[model samples]
Target: MNQRNSTQLHPPTRHFSVLLSPTPRGARLARLLATEWLRTWELPHHATEAAEHLVAELAANAATHGRLPGRDFRLALLAGSETLRVEVTDTRGDDLPHRRPATPDGESGRGLLLVEALSDRWGVELGPVPRKTVWAELDLSPEFGNVCSGGSGALLQETREGKKPHQAPPLPPTEPAHSRE
Candidate 1:
């Protein structure tokens, strides 16, 4: 069972949340969905890509380390004028994520290190009961303020009304068009 919701805290803040099964597929889906949403919001290319990676690592950790039978993990994205935050919550409060030195020959145990490197700041938060949310934040560049031409309120309204929010302008064709002879 998957659930999704969107919220507008204020004129400059936007939020999106979804609940997904705690599985490898779910973690992959979280990354894909987050990438699409970030692009829809017209965030800068670098920031969007960075956030995508952050979501992937955090969601993977939740699915792998925080798994509980019949429990779903939650992925939440908060976009503000100056920052973008990615969070993944699971039903394992006692199992908190920590950074450790990864062995050179080990294939695993490097997700948190990647998270720390890619995010401006990252941490874990314990919830009401039997839940924990791991979050990472990226500081947006000044030009990010100019990406949303329609304004955050308008975008939120479109989302609430079930209309597709404005998308970034399409990229130019790689080759120039030829003139008719």
Candidate 2:
């Protein structure tokens, strides 16, 4: 027999969730899975690409800075009419993330900075016990395509011109949109 729920009668709200071990491999998996799910949801290339890196950065932080001896992290993706939210919850509630200035010559510590540049808005949420969620949201409105047409390229250009990211202008539509992941 066929069974149907209320949401099944209409367009189901898009969401994906998973728990993964707190390890480097797990962080990599989180990015891969989110990318595929975003594609399945039919998001435009820009949203999918931004979300993929957002998930990667959050998951990497969870695995690197939030790992507990035996606990895993949770990854969740929720898509609304005009936004996609990515959340990575780890066991280190005491270790809230703060955005530090990006170093021009450093090898690491740029994850959160990238997250801020890519996401429309992002912040940390402390919770029930032994857990904290680092979340970022990307705009998926009609303007998304035009807004991020240059993606990381524009950010790089700003740096080369000695302009801080905040001092730079919105990315111009210099390239046709395409999926990078």
Best by TM-score: 2
Full-model lDDT, candidate 1 = 0.73
- Please report, as a residue range, the 10-residue window in candidate 1 with the lowest summed lDDT: 149-158
Rate residue 160 of model 2 by lDDT.
Answer: 21
> Residue pairs in steric clash, candidate 2?
none
lDDT of 2 by residue, 74-181 (tens): 999999876688999999988777544667898668886687667766666678788888877765653423446233433322222342322222122542222121
lDDT of 2 at 172: 27
lDDT of each: 0.73, 0.74
What is the number of backbone collisions in each predicted candidate, taken in the order shown?
Answer: 0, 0
1-181 per-residue lDDT for model 1 (tens digits) = 9987977765578799999989999999999999889999998776798889889989999999999989999999999886788999999998867655678998788887677556655666788699988877765652322332112211122132353423322223432211110
Deviation in Å, model 2, residue 169 alpha carbon: 26
Clashes of 1: 0
